[model samples]
Target: MFINKAFNMKYLSIFSILVFTLFSSCNNPSKTVNPEEILIQRIDSLNKAGYDITDYHAHLKGGLTIEELLEHSRTSGIRYGVAVNCGVGFPVQNDSALSAYYRSMKDYPVYQGMQAEGREWSTLFSADSVALFDYVFTDAMTFFDKEGRRNRLWMKDEVFIDDPEDFMEYLVTQIETILSTEKIDIYVNSSFLPDTLQSKYNELWTNERMQRVVTALKNNNIAMEINSRYKIPSAKFIKLAKAAGVKFTLGTNNTDANLGYLEYGLEMIRECDLKPEDFWKCKK
Candidate 1:
């Protein structure tokens, strides 16, 4: 009887261990989930958070046709405003070219934009032609400085900064002039600094100086662009502008086909806690 009892106890212990193993196997959590799947979930969360992001400054440069861009936009959950650079030295300089450009883009379900290059763009294209585009945008990037010297901030040779203080003042004035003068719906590449003065952006762009530009934008009813490629017009500037009732838009200003979703713009929206109402709307 004792031997039989001991054998029964051993069999019961073996059965208990087998049951636990099967239960654990059935309830095991996966150790690795696909990165793409996680990214999709994150993207869904972003969309849910009420940020209907639209990139207003994408380009079809680098051999990227409109069809290819549309395909990319559909998958990325980003609507695009494909901008054509229209001014002297650009392909779409005159009214005929501008008309053709606008007509060609009619089939695409994207906002067509005119990126006015240089101050001469105002005289180069007539008001009627300019108004045909969904939106028009320009930057203070190329302007005549205080000394009557034309300065293109992007190029090292074209830029001149003798005194940092003087340069900052001049740059601010130039921005205000552009905002007040240009008949642009959006101000692209806002607050861009020359390479020499770029490192001291925060220090140089004081509240007083920023306010001047902000006020100008407000008065002219121009929306500032949060440019992704440059990652410029720092968060501080954006917050200040928002408080001043100046609106903003997201732009990639892509030089190639690979324009990532406005990552920097999204970051600014989160960091600044921007709402949908804070963005500027094009005339639909």
Candidate 2:
């Protein structure tokens, strides 16, 4: 009787172990939750919220032709605005080149844009040709300081900040000048600071500074770009701009072909409670 009881106990232990193993395997959280599915759900959520998602600053760099870009955009459920940089140093500098660029892009269904690089873009291209594109955008990255030295805010060597206070003032003024003077539809890379002063972003970008930029955009009826690449112009700035009735546009500003969905812009949209009406769209 004792030997039979011990044999039965051993069999019971084996059965328990098998049951535990099966349960754990079936309940594995990692296997049960699919990341791809979650991403798709999030994309669907945005769509349901009436968000007309578009990546307005995509480029055909890194051997990704226009056709491939359109294909990727279609699959990702994002519309694209193809832009050509036209200014003093870029490929399409002169009026003829600008016209040719416009002609080339006219074949595609994508919204054509002209990225006005450098302050000289205003004089380089004619207004008639500039109006042909769907939209135009420029950043405050390049400007001439009071001393007449040209400061390219992105590059460390080219940037000049004499005094933090004075530099902030000048930067805000330059932005205001750009917004008031330039006839661009969207202001890309808004409120971007140089590497030297970027560490103090919160401090340097004070309420007064932000208000100046926001007011300029509002008065000029220009849309601000929510750039995904730099992920800049913080939530505070966006919120303030929104409160002041400034419109916004989403952009990746990609240097390469790998255009991921507008991650940061989408986050800002949710975080800032941006409505469809808050965004700007090209009518034509």
Candidate 3:
């Protein structure tokens, strides 16, 4: 009888262990929750709260067609502003080409954007032609340096960084000039540095410099773009600009078909406490 009782006790212990293992397996949190899904849920929650999460710098490069863009917008719950590159080197250089491009996209539901490229864009496109789009925007990327040499920040060959401090000062002045003189509604690629100076962005973009740019945006009534691709204009910059009553727009500035969700811009919205009223919306 004692032996039988001991055998039964061992069997009961094994059964209890099996039951506990099964329960733990069923309740495992890691198995049921995914990080990507959580991020999507958060984005959806923000959308439901009436925030118009739109990307104003989507390009048609890398074979990204309008139909594909529209489908991506529907699935991602993000509105889009399709932009065309307009300048001397780009395909849409003249007013006729610009008008043809606008006419081609007039029937689409997305906002048509004119990405005025290069410093000579003002001379290339007339005011009447510029007014044909929902909005016009430009960046300080293609500005002539103090040496009178044209510098495209993204191109390593074009960018000439002699002194970091001098470069920063020059860039800040160029941004001010663009804001003061250019007839643009938004300034895309705000606070971007060349690859050489990119790592020193925080050290270079001082409080005084940030304030100067913010003041320019406020004075000119131009909105600043929170670019997702470059993830520029740090939270500190955004907060300062917001305090100075500078409006902002979100942009992806995508070069390929894989247009990433505006992760950085959304994070800024939460961190900076940006409201829908602070965004630049198209009247059309």
Output the number of the TM-score-best candidate: 3
Give, for candidate 3, the lowest lDDT window spanning 10 residues.
34-43
The CA lDDT of each predicted structure is 0.87, 0.88, 0.91
Give one digit per residue, the lDDT tens place, for model 3 in 1-284. 99999999999999999999999998886888776566566668878988788889999889999999999888777889999999979989999999999999989989999999998899988889889899999999998887899999999999998999999999999999999999999999999999988899999999999999999999999999999999989999999999998999999999999777888998999999998888888877
Worst ten in a row by lDDT for model 1: 34-43
Tell me the TM-score of each prediction against the true structure. Answer: 0.86, 0.88, 0.89
Report clash pairs, candidate 2: none
RMSD (Å) of each candidate, 1 decimal: 4.3, 3.4, 3.1
lDDT of 2 by residue, 67-87 (tens): 999888676778899999888
Ranking by TM-score: 3, 2, 1
lDDT of 1 by residue, 1-284 (tens): 99999999999999999999889777763555554445444445776777667889999999988999999877777878999999877888899999998998877899999999988999999889988899999998888877899888899999887888998888888788888888999998888888888888899999999899999999999999999998988999999999988889999999998877677887898888788889998886
Which regions of candidate 3 fall more than 4 Å away from where they truly are? 1-36
Q: Candidate 1's error at 273, in angstroms?
A: 0.4
Residue 192's lDDT within candidate 2 is 86
Candidate 1 has which clashing residue pairs, if any? none
